[model samples]
Target: MTIAHILHRVADYDAWRKVYDSVGDMQKDGGVTQESVHRMVDDPDNLLVIHHFDTMESARAFFGRSDLRDAMERGGVQGEPRVELFE
Candidate 1:
């Protein structure tokens, strides 16, 4: 089944842009296929990241790794990201 991963952050556009740019190469190398990425117009600070994989297991395997977590932290992520998985 296909899975969906959602992320919500409370940082400004510049901050989020910096983090997104920093992770560009890593995300490509990590096997995450970006489906779509968008920011709410009403709330510029809110962002939604959507990615898809062959299975939930594959998604978890990639997301559960330490390198991604480290990259996120180093990218100045202030709070815990809300993650949701769905078919």
Candidate 2:
């Protein structure tokens, strides 16, 4: 099993969430099997997204996609996202 861990700050959680929810197909196409979202207690705008994949290669490929960047930008992401893969 592999997990793509994405951490980023968004300008507005509610607005970002709308865009995030709209990208369901992107996530499905990326080979994501499951997902979980978390928000920092002290900073509501800070978000952590965990996407479970069947393999590390899939996780890595998904994390490196330009479309993902575009999606994040469209979602009101405030800065560069921090991404990691765990297997």
Please name the candidate that would achieve the greatest TM-score relative to the true structure: 2
Taken over the whole model, the C-alpha lDDT of each candidate is: 0.70, 0.90
lDDT of 2 at 66: 93
Q: Candidate 2 has what TM-score?
A: 0.94
The TM-scores, one per candidate, come to 0.74, 0.94
Cα lDDT over the full model 2? 0.90
How do the residues 11-83 of candidate 2 rate in per-residue lDDT, one tens digit apiece? 9999999988998899999989999889999999999999999999888888888998898998899878998
- The residue ranges of model 1 lying beyond 4 angstroms of the native Cα positions read none
Off by over 4 Å in 2: none
- Global CA lDDT computed for model 1: 0.70
Model 1 TM-score is: 0.74
